[model samples]
Target: MLQGAGVVSLSGISTGAYATGIEPFRQVVTRYAIRPNPAAPWPAGLRLRIAVLTDIHACDPWMSLERIAGIVAATNALQADLVVLVGDFMVGQRYVTRIIPAAEWAPVLGGLAAPLGVHAVLGNHDWWEDPDALRRGGGPTASGTELTRNGIRVLSNEAVPLATRAGPVWLAGLEDQLALLPVRRRTGRGRLGLHDLAATLKAVPDGAPMILLAHEPDIFAQVPARVALTLSGHTHGGQVRLFGWSPVVPSRYPGRYAYGHVRERSDLVISGGLGLSIAPIRLGVPPEIVVVELGAEAVA
Candidate 1:
């Protein structure tokens, strides 16, 4: 399942146990360029750099504040114009309260510099926890009063127009497709749906190159065709994948869409993510911050 210079594969592991340990997970960081070609055409003169970090179950000590901070600092030094976080900000009940604590983690993450700023979306894990609480710390505030306080933008079923030197890039962040419930029954919620995605993307300016941040890559099946690229990272790239294969992958999507960059008619990039999930151990796929550059094709 290898495509071009990239590797594509499916996973068999579904549990959250194999995602522990700093040594194993630290290697998951990968870098790539997503420049536009004939098939994928962005604005000719506009070249934008995008950095992506996802599925960081920040509760794990391996992916400790120092490790996570280092990763963010490195990305900032790259001077990418935009930094995007996919999701799974927390690891359910385990690290619910400590997830991305602003007083600590934000100083490092918030220190990130990008002309367009940082943007993020919610994953099932975050939704399963206290979405209202997590939102209050980092990105968009639950009260919508601290949007600027944390220095990050959280997209949930909404589109924010980013003013770039080239003009404007319409960005949309979808609410976690997973179901939601009150505090007592948060994890008891049901599955998710893409019924709102189409309507959401349609709201964006037609013909404007659009990039979406959806925690789960499986949502691609229901997304509007106008979307150029969708960024995600819930699979941890098969956290404990052995020899490039995982015993199981916890994903709602069928087929090989559970991990990595799956190329359908459109483009999708899935980060292996920096932090751990259940057990906080990683094997093959390590944590990563992806770098993508967007532009037109080279002169032939």
Candidate 2:
């Protein structure tokens, strides 16, 4: 009778482990609205829906190509006016048992659809592997040309005006902060210069509202108030939270900008992202696809 009890106890323990360590891999859509700030100028009746997918540390046993397909399919269903991929397309380091090249994931990512266009920016992980390689090569096997062929514009320290029924909105992307680090310490934290920010904003038309895509939320402090919204992902909502508190948040600000909407000088939204890093487990924070809807406030 004691032996039988031991077997049942072990089985229960196994089930609980799966629930805590693996089930959080299941992704969810977290939606938010970006209302026009009184300080920022927005065209009347401007309503733009943007879908953001970031930190897709594509590998095996967890973030497989099949899983990416599901994420793409769901984002397409949202029918967003603009779709932006915030970066970290490949794993930072080989912590997982299985690894998949970025090439295999490109075609799947190309499947993403948005009415206006699909845009992407590099993340720290992309820089960690090889900055030149990531810039010249879209994925592991595919070249940068391949991603462009797929109609995805990979922006780097550049801005483009997107024509909308409401008005022209400037979409700007900054170079990964990690890229500025020294050769041996590229992954370490760094800061963006005001000149770099100015260069990106130079192309913007006067009085046009801007949306910036940056991978790390730490840069939120430097963005000018003129920027209507800044979208970022890198903290992964601390990946593992206990009772809404995360013990390890990978940000200079720690728990402050760990996740969700943060209103600083500018509006910042940090996505929890779609894959895992360091450890292959998530306890409380699940993978997410962020949908942000932008509209003008009611004229009361």
Which candidate has the top score in lDDT?
2
User: In order, what lDDT does every prediction score?
Assistant: 0.66, 0.78
Scanning candidate 1 in windows of ten residues, the lowest lDDT window is 7-16
lDDT of predicted model 2: 0.78
| Residue 254 local lDDT, model 2 | 88
lDDT of 2 by residue, 174-292 (tens): 76766434443444443432125677877677688899999888888888888889999988889877787889998889867888888777789999898877777676778999988
lDDT of 1: 0.66
TM-score of each: 0.77, 0.85
